[model samples]
Target: MKVAMVASHYPLPSHREEFVARVHQVADAFRRTPGCLTADCWLSADGDAVVSTVHWESEAARDASLATVMTAGLDIGYDERESRPREILHLVAR
Candidate 1:
C-alpha cells in the first residue's frame, strides 16, 4: 500500500533539512508501530510545498500506521489542503 502526503507552508522551505531530520526521528520513534516500510520526502523548487510518500507492506499495515500517525498528532494543515488521488496515467516508456 502506498500513501502520499502533501503539505505547504510559508516557511517550510527554509527548514527543509530540519523537517526531514525530524521526520526520520518520528519514524524511528514509531519503529515498533508496524506498517511503515519507508518514508521519502520531496520539496518544490519554490520552497513552499512538500510532498512525501510512504509505502507499507500491506493495506492493514497502512491503516495501522495511519492510526499511529493520528495518535501522534501528525497533522499539517495547508493554507490549502486537498485529499485526492494523484492520477498517474503512464509509467516509464522503457
Candidate 2:
C-alpha cells in the first residue's frame, strides 16, 4: 500500500534557515531512495516551522528506507536546532 509520512519541526528562530537547508538536502537524498515516490519540504508562513511530506511505494519500503537513512546518520539533527522534538504522522492511501 502507498504510504505518506509527514514530519514537522519547530526550529529556533536563529536556526530556521540552516534547518530548512538541511531538510532540503535530506529530502533530496530521500527522493533518490528506492520506492520513494516523492519528497517535499515546506516552510510555515510564520517562519518557525518546517514540514516534510514523503510518499512511498509501500510501508515496508518506507520502513526500510528510514532504517537505512537512520543507520547512515543522514537523519538531520532536528533536535539540535528545534525548540521541541519533531512530530511525525504516517497514513495509508485509502
Candidate 3:
C-alpha cells in the first residue's frame, strides 16, 4: 500500500527561515529517492509552523529512505533549533 508521512516543525523565531530551507532540502532529497512518489514542504495555515508531506511507494520504502537520508547527514537537528519537538504522522490511502 502507498503511504504518506507528514511532519510539522515549529522552529524558534530566529531559525524559521533556516528550518524551512532545511525541510525543503529534505523534501528534495526524498523526491530523488527510489521509492518516493512525491514530496513537498508548506507553511501551516496559521503560519506558525512548517510542514513536510512525503508520499512513498510503501511504508517500508519510507523507512528505508529515512534511514538512508539521516545517515547521509540530512538531519537538520530540529530538536536543537525548534521551539518544541517536531510532530510526525503516518497515513495510508483509503
- The best candidate by TM-score is 3
- How far residue 50's Cα lies from its native spot in candidate 3, in Å, is 0.5
Model 3, 1-94: lDDT tens digits are: 9999889999888988888899998988888888999999999878789999999999889898887777768866657688888899999988
Error of 2 at 9 (Å): 0.4
Backbone clash pairs in model 1 (N, Cα, C under 3 Å; residues 3+ apart or in different chains), count: 0
**What TM-score goes with each of the models?**
0.50, 0.90, 0.90
Model 2 Cα shift for residue 67 (angstroms): 1.6
Q: Evaluate all candidate structures by whole-model CA lDDT and list the values in order.
A: 0.51, 0.85, 0.87
Candidate 3 stretches with Cα past 4 Å from truth are none
**Runs with alpha carbons beyond 4 Å of true place in candidate 1:** 1-32, 74-94
Listed per candidate, the RMSD to the true structure in angstroms reads: 6.4, 1.4, 1.2
By summed lDDT, which 10 consecutive residues of candidate 3 come out lowest? 71-80
True-structure lDDT of candidate 3: 0.87
Model 1 scores a C-alpha lDDT of 0.51
Question: How many clashes in each structure?
Answer: 0, 0, 0
